[model samples]
Target: MNRVYNFAAGPATLPLPVLQTMQAELLDFKGTGTSVMEMSHRGAVYTEVITRARESFKRLLNVPDNYKILFMQGGAIGQNAIIPLNLMGGARKTIDSVISGAWAVKTQAEAARYADAAPIIANSCDAAGRFVSFPEFTTWNRSADAAYINICTNETIHGVEWYPSDAEAAVVNASGAFLVADMSSHILSRPLNVANYGVIYGGAQKNIGPAGVTFVIVRDDLLDMQHPLCPAAFNWRNVADNDSMFNTPPTLSIYIAGLVFEWLESMGGVAAMAALNDAKAKLLYDFIDNSKLYRNDVQSKYRSCMNVPFFLNDESLNAAFLEQSAAAGLAALKGHKMVGGMRASIYNAMPIEGVRALVGFMGEFERQNGQAF
Candidate 1:
């Protein structure tokens, strides 16, 4: 069977060239006569892979010299606890979070266990109670001397994102706190200002590589603030001090991630990807906005470029839509259960051709089903 356009939120898709390169190198990586998976993490060959991966990430994001990029194991969920365990140990134990969607709620709930997790800054919903928009910066209610304020830059399930803005950094600075961002689903999809954040973390499954590794970029000052109870492996200071090799790292995933970084460089880096993503998002959103049979409830300004969730006008057609879309070579269009609808996750690896095909299919589905709705 031919490769289908994958719209799943995570472990989503990799660039074809990256996959092909991995296939070519799977048996004997860089003439080592052993697979990357089989090599020791401390070996010179594997060290080069991890170093290149880390350096490429820093270069692509333009990360500052004061921040350490450590490839740790644990999905974003695990960081919910890990973040507080590290940062909340200081005299300032308050963590303020803006409730954007489901993931933000979870991250704050976990932080509550370790710190004085304050009331949410603001909800994404408006007066009508639709999870379609984001709170304005002026509306934020922050705690005094809070250790850090958390925000998920992108909510994968609800298809909401905090669009790039300087207001977030301003708020953090004014509140006497650093910013901790969960950029799991949309980290590498656009250009970023790394200095504005104290820590930026995300899982590798979506835009980076596979499932085993999680990337954390932390400023130098935050490294030593971990609680004594924090495990050596989960401690950012220890992880950085040992150069992300305190324990065996995810060798294969790091290798593949390095290939992806190189691929992104060849494709003109994140700024170029951002342009392509905007075009793809425009194509899909424009179609949905003009369609009578489908609607995306997300507010125009806050809608995520990486994930688009839309509902059919007639709910009864959802099963048929999913079935037919899959049979037509589109996969994982089902929305998260918390929100019942169809979601198309177009991450970095997904091509514009795939988005065009999806728009074509959606148009056909709308045409055939419009009379009923």
Candidate 2:
């Protein structure tokens, strides 16, 4: 009955309360005598689930009335093509991408397939192909008639985050382009002012629930711009018109996400979650900063609260570190292969005690390894 503190980047840990709720309703959901997964998506039971989930999400994020929350099937990668396909109809053929890391780079490449031109506005990688920091907003070369400007608000692999600032908003607004963000890693970790961007899309696996469900909140005005060739299923307008039911939705994933939304609400919603996440990030980052053996490369101002990527000063200790951490009940501390280090993803389900335990384990590991931390 032991549960390790899981830190996988996505399809990551979920709240125990949410899991319990799902278990309780697994066989019979609200007197229906059937699992939500066993029901028809078009049935009344499913309708209630979708409605409550959307409304809970709206309340939690304070999403505006002008935005439509579409529970989609494809992950953020799907949105990369779907976004341009839907939004590039009337605007110029060019799409501007601000590349911050691997995810953003992948997004730009995907956008190229849909748009006539996909221009890199700013690429943050250095000659060694390391993502150290975000390019300054002033340094970007935006297109005059660009269909939209795309940015990954938090680069999960590189561990960079962009807090919405007036300068950033002004820059996007001045270009007369819709601001689209891939917020996959840090979607529900904090409060977002939805009006600041035209579209915000993220896979639910990280901060929300299980895989197979993605959420896209698009401003209403951006719906009608889809190209004639856009697939009916991928078209935002069609998805919206059908209320994200054009095809059979991901029922189990959506239902689990609804349970998570309810769990979040019971725990005092996103504002409270943001405060908790801030404390958790600080706990881990401060330990990394002060430790002589471990180092975090991301610039302090842009470091992600959800994903903290750090490297051991002695690269030889990587395997031992992971093994000992696993033995101590800390799981998935391995960093992405592109970045050879350790990454601790402290998502919503990661309690403060988990971070404290990890810090303690790191200290013990350094001492046993004869390194001063």
Candidate 3:
């Protein structure tokens, strides 16, 4: 029972209760005399599981009735191209993107392959070329004839989060274009207004479940705009029509996600999770801000609550810090190579005690290494 606190970005940490429940039923789920993985996806028992999962997810997120939740494969990376293929055939045939960090850039690049013109509406880079702050809403140069405006709500690598402001909401509302968000890393960590976006999607590995399932919540009206080249499985309209069984959906992963939804509900849903997440993020961010040996690059207003990327003041100490942290029962403290620093991803499954442990370790490490740096 010696479990270390895991902080990997995806395929990260899941709630222990959910994991235990799964372990309890792994061999024979619900008296069916078979594991969930062995059951037929189209069978009555499996159908009940998927239906409950979708319903629980909808209830937790308060998803609008008009939105269809499709469980598809390919994660967010696959959605990058699929989104453009499905939505770019609109009359405008253009995609307006807000470049915040790595994922947004990838999505925009993929969209460009299908869009008539994919333009950068806003970029969150400073004059020094660091992706630290989000560009103001007024500074966004949106296309007059864009099919959809794309934005990554949270950048997992660069550690920036896009919190919707009144002005930003007003701007999007007036644009008459569908708002598309890549909410992969921070999807259910906070409460979201599902009505605000035409499409919201993410990979389940981050905070929901395993890596096999990707969830797409699309508005009904937007489903009919797929390009002629869109694949039957990747097409949102077709997937929705087939109830996300256009291909064999991620059966086992979806089953785990269903348990997570139930766990969230028992913990008071997204609102409660948001409050706890705020506390966890604040604890770590405040510690880093006050420490002389560590520093976080992203601007205060744009900091990601889920993924907090920080660097040691002395580059030479990076390896030592990682080694010591792992020895001390902290795992996956290494940052993405794109942003070479230490990243602590404290997702919903991370309790405040974990963040407190991290902060305590940071303080001790600084105490020993501060004078030298």
Worst 10 residues of 3 by lDDT: 162-171
- Worst 10 contiguous positions by lDDT, candidate 2: 163-172
Q: List the candidates' TM-scores in order.
A: 0.97, 0.97, 0.98
Over 1-373, each residue of candidate 2 has an lDDT whose tens digit, in order, gives: 7989998999899999888888898889999998899999999989999989989999999999999999998899888888888987875788999989999998999889888889999988989898878877788898888888889999998899985576677678777887899999998888988888989998999999999999999999999998888899988888899988999999999989988999999999999999999999999999989888999988898899999999999889999999999999999999999997999999988999999999999988888886433
* Alpha-carbon RMSD, each predicted model: 1.3, 1.3, 1.1
Q: Can you list the residue pairs that collide in candidate 3?
A: none
- The 0-to-1 C-alpha lDDT of every candidate, in the order given, reads 0.89, 0.90, 0.90
Clashes of each: 0, 0, 0
Model 2 sits at a Cα RMSD from the real structure of 1.3
The total number of steric clashes, by the backbone 3 Å criterion, in model 1 comes to 0
TM-score of 3: 0.98
Candidate 1 or 3, higher lDDT? Answer: 3
lDDT of 3 by residue, 1-373 (tens): 9999999998999999999999999998999999999999999999999999999999988998999999999999999988888886678798999999888899999988999899999998777666887777678898888788889999999899986665666678687886889999998898888888889998999989989999999999999888899998899988999888988999999999999999999999999999999999999999899888999988898999999999998999999999999999999999999889899999999989999999999999999886787
